[model samples]
Target: MAKRDLRALMQPAAAGMFMKQFLRWALVCCAGVFLAYTLSALKVNKAPSDPWAAHCLSQFLSDARSFSTATSDLKTTVNDLSAGDTASLTHARQALLRCRLSYKKIEYFMEYFFAYPVNLYNRAPVHEIEEPYMEYQSPVGLQLIEDLLYGEDPFAQKQALQEQAAVVQSTAADIPASVYGFEATGVQVAESLSQELIRVMALGIAGYDAPVCKSGLPESAVALQSVKAVLAAKTAGEQNLYADSCMHYLDKAIVLLQASTGFDTFDRLSLLTDALLPAQEYLNRYCCQQYPGIGGEGAYNYNARHLFRPDALRQAAFDRLAQSDTAAGLVALGKLLFSDNRLSGDNTRSCATCHKPSLYFSDGLKGSPTIGNGGSTRRNAPSLLYSSYQYGQFLDARDASLEKQIYTVLQNPDEMHSRLDDVVRKLDNKTYRPLLRKAFSQAGKQITPAMIARAIAAYERSLSPFNSAFDRYINGDHNAMNVSQRRGFNLFMGKALCGTCHFAPLFNGTLPPLFNRTELEVLGTPDGGSLDKPVPDTDSGRFGIFPIEFYQYAFKTPTVRNAGETAPYMHNGSFTTLEDLIEFYNRGGGAGIGLEVPTQTLSPRKLNLSQAEIADLKSFMLALKDSL
Candidate 1:
């Protein structure tokens, strides 16, 4: 152990430590350089600054904060209702109404951008059936709370009401995070405004959301005000004529809403045609001018002038074979096949057998007779007119597409009783082979059942003529619909709540401005249209398909168009006369007549339509009959 040996060992250790420190310093410098380069690249690739979008985002955040605060207040008020008196209940309802007003202000953006969270805030107060998997989602949100508070005994369901309010409050708190960094463009703003206008007309004025409170008019006015505010924010310093026009119409609409006497007496037709439609047109035009060749996603055609226009919706959006070029030829072939009995098992029945051309594609019978038997089909034959425009087919909505519906009918024991494969083989004749080849020239030589379905569907799609008197009237021919018809149209769209489910101008279950899902409602239709002794129809309807308790007696809302020609109404064809059908609705479906329908989606409240109003409604429906 010499002093020189100890010094040598320390020197080697010091040299190793120095080398490690130098390497660490070099790595840090490299990391700094890389980080600087990455930052520079990010800056270069960043989207250009949009002042309009920035302003909207700022406004959205502010509105979202207000909504959150209002919901918190509502939650607090609801909590107090448990131990408080009638005054406390009144205060809770008032707080709920305040929350609704605040939510309405931001509903357009929230619904368009954040649909999932919006469901928790204000979905239809019914058990929603999640498709394919058939998951039953229990109803939550504002609508449910409204139903509870407005019920006969709100105190009895205090626990349920408070829970729903909490859901709304919690969902509201996440609004800012849900919309963080959401880039709002002129196209989106325009589309969202147009959609809001449609919502206000179809659902709002019809009292779809305000089921019990009947505060749709005031709520709609607030919504329009919010829309006006957003438009002003976008066109803050711009010299746009369309923006000015849009604002003018929006103001008129808000005024009309505010001036409304009551839900049943609101001049919804005037507001729709004079104010909302004009506002929608100008807003769409403004968006088009601002962002040319740009369109938002969905079933709506942004380029269309108004909702009532024949081309307002992208019809092809619902069809699977939208891009097919042989539509004309397919329609012709389908027409022949539709009437040909060779596709049926007994060669005695055809699609045309039940769907008669003279009756507007519906048989005049209560229910079409079954093939080769003394029985009848399970449900009444719905008119083929405008059937292709909807997302769901059949009264029960078991089939998702027209093709599937056709196939099901063909194979059903009581209907065609012929397999699709059999039908394809039956169509191998010289008359059909050539037509099939010409229609499906793109496909291989062999014909398939799907080809048959597609051909038939093509013909069905062509069935939408949009040439009814109502259609003509909406398309600028004011003389088409008479005064009574016009008045009826107003009632149908507003007080009667027909437009809420049977949305215009299709007057079917297909929802707009995104006509993606078809709605099924439980009207609690009776087995027979007897006002004295009403009995709920035993038909399981949608429950047969989904097996959910809420789906019991749920049936697809069929189109009311051409009802004058297509006589027997309801899935069972129980009501023979239009008057009886109207009476049934006036009495509030089956529930109003004392039927116990626990899952009835239709409101049990009576419509209380007058005799004159009923006549007007009938007149409007008659006007819907196509010239064809």
Candidate 2:
């Protein structure tokens, strides 16, 4: 081809390249236009750069912690703020004006809900949400909770259910979860205890005391002496030999319990009703002969519960759980998570450390020490055995339910001083998701404090060790206790007024549902004297919650069962022995004030126990104890 023809071909190729470049530039321009439009839709204009607003937001979070024991100011600020301090709450005042996060607000009130269920049940003061603006007007947080909890709208129901999750999460949110509330060992321990409780309750009536029983002797002195002689034996072998040797003679005892065959002339029913100690002894022997593992199956001891109410629940919840692999899987997964200390920020503790199963799921301490520098609080660490049955918690009766109680302890600086932020981070851990997914059959929305609380609560209810000698005695065991224990029981009910606080069966500080220890009372307890004028732990009692003079120096009343093992009694480990406590009660509690009076009509009159009577009372309390 000629030079002109070659230039023409090259010119066409050059033209195509120019067109391609033009189209590419046009497309780029269109894309930029679309991006600009999208950005504008978000209304991304920066707020009139208010340095004050920015400073306020920063200051608000710095000063306001969402922890339950939050300072009044901080508490006020968080409730009013809608956005997190990092978000729209651009000023301290703004953040302190409106609560934005639904979860945070719900949790804040949930703490109150569990703390005062009856109070809320009767009158849920809707204005509390206005706490941030208590002095002002708009009731934002309170309205939100009220709308959800008591609202009829579909949206409200949905919100209420979702709120439960937040409620559970709220407790441990402050927990770093380095080791499952590692930020606060007490929280971890309480959570651990909660888990144990849930697990125990699932056993259902399996561990509950049956009403059938044993009845042994009418003559209190003879029965008491006989039982004491057996007890005084140096070894388990000796006790057993005496029991077994007497088995032939026990025909009279057995007849006394089951029937009045030989005692036809006596009031057999009355004799049976009066034989607490003899009943305890008979049950103990029977229990030793029947089941092992009572006191570790050693010849050292025999738990009498087996004879009367052995695994007596009419319906075991675990039976339902065991029926399906899914439920079992969930429980197993929960058990693992419950035991995993890795949930802690530092892997230093788990739910099991303080709520060890071996210890009947209670810390073997007068009072659990604080996980932080704040130090431990007053009260003996109550056993977590019948926690599910508890109507109120702590020796001070501060918390109401297991879930809320668990949360309170979680947030307590002396307890679980853990940060919820840390817990969420760990619960959201990528590695654990698969296990959680398999366990719950659904990978839940990252582990929240609410989820942890509920899970632990479910687990804690399972720790009940039902069917003790005392229970058998109540059911039908006449020989469950000696004559002294029987008389003591009589005094406990008729004279001591113990049944008024600690109900039957579980012996927790409640008479079923609405009847609870939520009511405040001042025992006028003698101030535990120290080298210092005012002891460091002088409990102002419920007065700390409200400054009423009448609400002075009062604490919670724990269950009387298991009193033998859980020592160092009272609010601040004040009394060293049960005898001392008895004496304190006999003298009345306000001795220091020269009153030593019981504030309640139920008590306050001195126990007025004579020396012999004190021994009898002690023996009766002894009936409440049993192996875990």
Candidate 3:
């Protein structure tokens, strides 16, 4: 300030300056310490390099590049098809096959990691109606191209084919950016391989994508080879027995698929039982050995040995509520309620009246008699076997779960003709009260509609007894299925295209690997089994529920597991015998029989199955009957 009256002011000013200098030095030191700490933390938190991620990224990029190139070539070839010449058509077809092969090589990763984008690359050829929004997405990608090129007039569809090929090439070009930073762990790679195997079995062999081209067998071989390559990359230099066994089985399967005589003649049963199943078992074991504490994060149970193993799928993953130890008690109570006629309005009919236990839970009638005998029920009663595994229930797939399905049936006027509350009240007597109390002890002496529904659903869920001859055959009893049954199984899975909708293991509408959705198809079933005078069934089926145009007359694909005992097939119960039913499908549903079924999803082309083949198919279905 002032010179402090000479010496005093000078001393005060000098001391203040020294204090300021000390503070500056302290601030600089603190900043230096903070910077060092930040650097140390950054180094500590840095992720370790993942060899699996590196290998997967490399393979994905390589395949993506090949796919992009193939699709570009496909587009050019398809454009040339506008000339409408035989040579142009042949070149286009060959280019399309090459494009498909390239796509299959990378399908596992694309489907596993990027489902939404991949849809544009290989969705079903049909126009898909997105529910709620009702957005109709016209078919695009390889399937549509395959259909167009193989249709009766490929020349007429040249422009459309060219557009689809362009879409596919554009989608392929974006693949690398879409998976730019994807880090694949060993467990995920293993899980992807397992899921790919299911896809190959269910969709690949069944000609799901190559419906017209009949290139499914070769595509499946390429897909399997890609899986083998991934497995080898992961287990490189490892001498584990499980790894060796997995490789051996995969090699055997690849060889078998490559040497296939034709799609219809391929021994699918042997390939499945002897190669795919065994390979899955060994691969699962190897994964467990390598990554002991890791677990899968989807519907599939990565720890399971094979697809047919009881624990292969996490069943609880599909359930709306988590299952508990009380399920056993709930199942017992449900069984009692399922048979009690008192639950019906008139107390004269029960679930067993329609779904009789003696006939594999299906009444041996064209359609079961209505609750009070006015007219027959609209649809035939479907068997309760394996009903719980599906995402939707009933012929129309109107119900999302077994519990909801039971509730609807209890309240339907044409069925039980009773409300859930009425059923609960009827079951409050000594015969059911104690059982209900034990099953739902946490509810504290209250009997509710939900409890009844849960109990009945639990009982239905308990009916999935995978102990049929087919199950035994797949699980290592080579003699369980006879030669006729084996041939039939192959026909059903391969030539018949049954496995695409009625997926294996469960043999129902539920899609596997990711058991997230149930599919419905418009088969255009006739009103009666008269092929000469075929008429489309009046029942609207799934269209009654969703009201989507494409879903007109669509119905859930019922399991053929116990077709032997559950006669009178289809929603209308129009076909009275297995032979007649096979004949109907052989002739190609209603459309093929000259019925006006505009939305018929079933191919109108004849199956041309021999009588012996039909007999074999029946035998295979009969073999699906459980040992109940």
Return the top candidate by TM-score: 3
TM-scores, all candidates, are: 0.88, 0.46, 0.89
Please list the C-alpha lDDT of all candidates, in the order they appear: 0.78, 0.41, 0.78
**Tens-place lDDT digits, model 3, residues 230-280:** 888877886778888988998999999999989988998888888988998
* TM-score of candidate 3 versus the correct structure, residues matched by position: 0.89
Error of 2 at 491 (Å): 2.3
Model 2, position 212, has a per-residue lDDT of: 9
TM-score of 2: 0.46
User: Candidate 2's C-alpha lDDT?
Assistant: 0.41
Residue-by-residue lDDT tens digits, candidate 2, 240-338: 553444343334443443443321122322332344324434545544453333333111123432212433221122122222333444555556666
Off by over 4 Å in 3: 1-49, 82-84, 130-135, 292-297, 325-328, 442-444
| Pairs clashing within candidate 3 | 4-9
